[model samples]
Target chain A: MNRQSLKLSMEIARVHLVSKPKQTIVAMLGVTFGIGMFIALVSLMTGLNNFTEELTMTASPDIHIYQEETSSRKSILEEINPDGLNLVYHQKPKNETTKIRNAREIARLINLDARVLGTSPLVSSQVFYNYGPVQLNGTILGVDILDEDKLFDLRSKMKAGRLEDLLSNHNGLIMGKGLAKKLNVALGDRVVVTTPLGTTITLKILGIFQIGIGVVDNVRSYANISTVQTILQKDQSYITDINVKLKDRNLAPLVASELQSKFIYKSEDWQAANATYLTGSMIRNIITYAVSFTLLIVAGFGIYNILNMTIYNKMKDIAILKAMGFAGVDVKNIFMIQSLVIGFLGGIAGLVIGYGLSFLISKAPFNGGDIISLDHFPVNFDPMYYVVGIVFGVSTTAVAGYMPSRKASKVDPIEILRGQ
Target chain B: MEPILTTKGVNKFFYEPEKFQVLKSIDLTVNKGEFLSLVGKSGCGKSTLMYVLSTMDTDYEGELQIAGQRLTGKSQNELAAFRNAHIGFVFQFHYLLPEFSVLQNVMIPALKLNRYSRKEIEERAMTKLKMLGIDEHARKASSKLSGGQQQRVAIARALINDPDIIMGDEPTGNLDSYNTQLVFDIFSELTHTYKQTIIAVTHDDEFANKSDHRVEMSDGRIVKS
Candidate 1:
């Protein structure tokens, strides 16, 4: 209870641990390996998760607003008298425009809201790219190059020319690298495009980009809004889609619902669009924690085993100490201090080793091939993980040491002395 | 001389291996500064009685008092503190912690007592070791010493706290005749020259005959004093 007694207990503990150097180091290594693996696995897994999340999240807007075609199959007879049983055998599909009315006005109004970071209008249509003798299907997206760059950071994804080139040349288009490869076209090369309306035009390639998604990279291309409007033969106000980026992406679902009700259009948030990927992320997180915790607990058991053996070996010492007027608490403290010292030292070593391993992993080469463009493995060096790892390690050892220390304290000196 | 330790109607039982009585209504008293010995055959409860008197065994029925303080019904922690400050013990085996130096082993009880400064405690420990003629080995590990020297170190440890009474459970049981004689002389000097009270349990008749008073026990009861 007093400082002097505690000092004595610590002294005894230090001596005991030092006496059996081999056993002490073995016990410490258990914790060291457990915590080290925990740090490495958690940091790498989280880093990968963040990398994948950014790849998908930044490529698409937080909220997408577009017009959806809907046609009711109800006949005129049913509309006049709903109770009457009226059935139409073969219902004809109704023709409706997929373009949103007043799309520019909606974008401007949505941008005025404090939550909205920016909004970019897009006019996209399916087309066919014609090389000399080869033809491939693709989708052309018409966007204001500067606004698109602000929303999606398009400039960084550019592999060849700049967005400024597309803006300057009216007939210029930026093509995905995969599409460019397929058509055998490079920057400043001319390619023939046939629109869905059978309107053919020759457009010069201004830039080449790669978004890392195979399907998108193989078929998607970018062009100026006016050029796409002229190719589609639509007026200046024609817009098919509005992409909304928010300051806080977490508010996307709520804002999307509000926009849907206000504009009478289909509004989809990124989470809803990528529900499967979110579930996969959650599963990966669960696995990471489960494995890390198992490693730590195994390490804890190692400490427990070593402490128990130490207590068993030192039974005579405990009895003698008790006989010398050392209290039960003092004996317990001596053993407890041994375990804590191991935990503290092992946890520190684990942190250092974990950092070293993470650094190595971050520099390791990664070939994502045509699917994703990455040169090195991802590893996040978050300080919070280190704090959590050490705290968990120490507390685990404490719990593990508790039972053996209690047994040591409860030892009856009389029994031991009598047996001797 | 005034009585320093007294017991009235002390009784103890062992529950394991079926119920059996170990100490039966034991009543004894020892004067201050007296060297007393409890002698009996093996399993006659001399050792059990010693444990009870030393406050290490509290499972007994009767009043036990030492240095005019009733020690019955005291908590284990309180009894441990009392033992640290007031009573010392010398076991049959020289049970020194193998990893600690001779001086640290002697200073353990005094450190637990915490009444004196660390420097003062160290000085007292050194004095006790010198008095026992083991000062040259103070810095050596206790386990590295001979049996006689280790027993002497145990004696020094007992004396470091200046306890009122020193109890021994066959302190010379494992020693040869020469070492046994050395320990006997140490106990005699501790009592006569230092005016320290001592109670030892021994099977050696010669050792018992020379003590100030000898108490004999048979089958858990004191037969004669």
Candidate 2:
């Protein structure tokens, strides 16, 4: 507890460490490499997880609420025997419907929830697009243009023309780039869409957009809700799906389950739809931590080896220090201080090196394909990883240095002197 | 004057190779300000006796009291504190820490004693070095000094805490005749001028014969005192 003693002990530790330059450098390098890799790999793993989450969020709605599918049954008669004495009738499902009866009221109630950012009612139909001898199958989605734009941030993805054009012109349609290409049409061209219910509607192409995903670009087109409803012979309040965007994307699963439990609707969150990606991120995190911790422990063993050797070489010095009236604990403190010094300097050096590595990797060129959102290798510069590395490094070095320091303290000055 | 250190019926055994007694039962006392020499041929147990008296070797079966305190059966920590406060040791090897400055080496014992602040310890260490005529070399590492100069530094270190007794095991063993005589004169001045007690083990007949008192040992028993 004496400040002078502590200062003297630290001085002794510094002297010993500086005396053996080669061995001390090797021990420090071991720790530096361990901690540096720890920060680098952990940050990269975290960044990849964030990237995956961002992409998943962009490609799916935060929440989707829909009517549960209802099964219909028909009675069919079958022979019971060859003599046909008795006949049996069995009920079998022949139809399924998923149309919400009063979707406008449900949308209104959802909008009243404080957590809801926006909600858009959707009536999607499987249909065929025909333009002068060319035909293709796709989906015709009926949506309120402004509401759908708020839910999907659709205006930013527009390739040509504006999404507002659909609002001004009732018969106007917004088609994906791939769908417009298949019909050999451009903006202001007319195309006929035939629904499965045998309703044909002519829609003028108001805008074209590409979401970068080939499947979505090739098969999706949008029209105003009222026009599609009239053509499909549906009630004004009819809607098959409601897309809900929340203020906090992270709370989507919680709110989805809450809504589902309170109503008869089937609600799904984006996270639930892509659970595998989240689990993959969890597994990556576990692997990163395991590898980093193992390396740090290995670095600790390096410290142990060097310190043990230093104690063995300094036996005479230890005897002399003991003779000078340094207590066992004080002698131990001297060597433990040596390890802590190495840990401290090495931790700092590792953090700097890790930050440099992360920055370099973040700047490295990467040929991003159609799937990923990043132009370069993603790296998260989280401060917590560096903090963790420092704590782990220093503590592991202390534990490793303890055994050798204890040995140094127990050295018999008399025996060493007499042996000489 | 009252005795500064006393040992009664001190016995030591070595279990290595065989159980052999090193120090036989011996009774000894040295008064305050006494300059004493324990002299014997190699393996005559003079060093073992000094070890036991210095409280560095506690395996001996004996009753030991130094500076009016019982030192026998004390823990290693207690013995360390006792040694720091009351007994200082100078070894044959002049075992100064090689990596430290001469002044820092001299200040270590006093720092461990915790009797003074760091600045005060440094000043006391400088005075001890000046007394030994090594003040100019205080800033240099101990290992950079000559064998004789390092021994002088070691002596300065022993005197820093101003203990009741300064014990040396062959204090001039590694030095030439000039340095040996110089060490002898320093010990004489410490005992006569400063009223400090010194107990040194020596093989040199001239060094032993000139001391205030001489205790010669043979086969672990005191032959002459």
Candidate 3:
């Protein structure tokens, strides 16, 4: 009833658990191994997801404004010139006026919304870089470079020279170190950049950067947006996408809705674009639950075995109980309590071992690289795991204890003495 | 005097497909604090009647009562609870939990009783063990005790719960003469000191003759004493 009796009973159960030391340790080892497997597998999958999400974090918007554009084709070349590559593509350009007007007007529209952290304009174009003999086709980004550090942290990671060279110098550019290396370009080297308008402009590579993003590091070149727009001789209307930032993580959806309504009605929020997170979470949950169910049932088998043996051994004791005016239910409870203790102790062991192993693995060298990702495993053992585990352990033990305890209760002290 | 334990025309039979009558019509009673012995040969239904009075088995056609309650038509749990509150039992084999010490074995019944405090139960168990002169062995495992001493411990354990009636089934059947005599001597002391009703099943006429009253049984029928 109290902790004292519970302690005593647990001590008694402990003795019984270790009575067959080899069996007890072996059984516990099986559970530990199973739980450790759970930890390892879950951590690996979560690590993979986190790594992918980390990659997304590097490239995706602080907040993305989605237009009604289906992003099926990936390669810049394939997306721009679909019919030229044996595919009959007949997609027309979007209404540039509406898109540009909406993106440009959001800066003046909202009345200083607290959740509106920042808004940035983005324009991406496929441009070719010409060096001595290398012609590297790469993404030419026209970033504001104004408070650019807050949005992407890219300028801070400049491998050589100064990031200001791209802004102060009118005809300056910056490419990732790998991209520069591939194009045989270096700091202060002049290169020709062809924009989507088919206008070629000469730019000096004042700096090179490396941020561990293979996709970005190998194929990205950036310049001042106004310089690109002026050099291309476009109009005062050239905002491809407007990236918005929210003050708090929880306010992202609400802010996204407000921004969508206030900025551009057709723009998508972060959650709708990151559907894989929701779906991946559901899949991970299902997997974790299925594994735990299968394993604890196996663990329950051990509990069942222990209780069954205890009940069989204590048949005469149960008969004595009946003779002593203990009802069958009381006798059942004694054994039931014994199993519960076993399950509880074992469950705690499993949880600690499971979560502990996951933590160790999380710190382990499991991730495939050192770029934008982890080397350790990951395990998010939420409250749900504990609730399920304890319930499963206790109920399994109780059910396991049920049969033998009931059998013990049915014993007749008289019949037992008389050998009936 | 109103008997502390009684049975009226008790008839018991074990029936599967074949009906086996273990006890015939029998009437018996023992006054409070009296030591009574039921002496019979093997298969004479002495054990059956003992079980009936101890409330171990309730399926029987008889007016069997212990302490104050009628012992028929009650559920098995009710019978078990009844016995737990009122009856203490000893067997000839000295059926103690070998895993426990002598004191622990004696305290088992009291631990099952919610009414008894742990200190009170231990004190009661010690008192019984001391009276039977096995106090010094209380801490020793029951399995390690000498046979006579072990039987004495068993008697002490049966008396530990302070039941209104103590029933022994062939209490000395498995013991040597020394242990057997030791066991009967404890029963005598139990009756005299605790004013307890003692009913023992025995094959030895001499052992039964020492009781305040003796009933003899033959072929499941109680005939003479």
lDDT of 3 at B24: 86
The candidate that achieves the highest TM-score relative to the unseen native structure: 1
The residue-by-residue lDDT of candidate 1 on B138-212, one tens digit each, is 999888999999999989988888889999999999999999999999999988999999999999999999999
Put down candidate 3 lDDT per residue, B1-225, tens digits, no spaces: 667877888888888768988888878878899898998778788877887777766688879877778877887766666676688887866777666789988886667665678899889899888888889999998889988888788777777767888888888888888877777787887789778888888888889888898988889898885
lDDT of 1 by residue, A1-420 (tens): 888889999999999989999999999999999899999999999999998898898677999998777634577778899998787887765677788999999999999999999999999899999988777999999999899988998899899998899888999999999999989889989999999999899999999998777667899999998989899999988899999999999999999999998998999999999899899999999999999889999999999999999999999999988888888999999999999999989999999988999999999999987787788998999999999999999999999998999999999998998788
After best superposition, candidate 2 residue A310: deviation in angstroms?
A: 2.5
Task: Write out the backbone clash pairs for model 2.
Answer: none
Candidate 1 residue spans exceeding 4 A from truth: A70-93
**Candidate 2's DockQ:** 0.74
- The lDDT of model 1 is 0.92
What's the ranking of the predictions by lDDT, best on top?
1, 2, 3
RMSD of each: 2.0, 4.7, 6.3
lDDT (10s digit) by residue, model 3, range A1-420: 333434434444554555567756655554555554555555556656666665666566546764545433345667787777654466555444324564567654532676666667766667888765656788877777764556667766778987777778878887887788777878888888776667788988888887666777888877888776676575657766667665654566777676777655455556666778658867976887678667767776776676677667866665654665566666566666666666666666776776777677666666545244344455454556555555666676667667766776566665565672
- Report the alpha-carbon TM-score of model 2 versus the true structure: 0.87
DockQ for all models: 0.82, 0.74, 0.50
lDDT of residue B140 for candidate 1? 99
Task: Tell how far residue A153 is off in model 2, in angstroms.
Answer: 3.3
Report clash pairs, candidate 1.
none
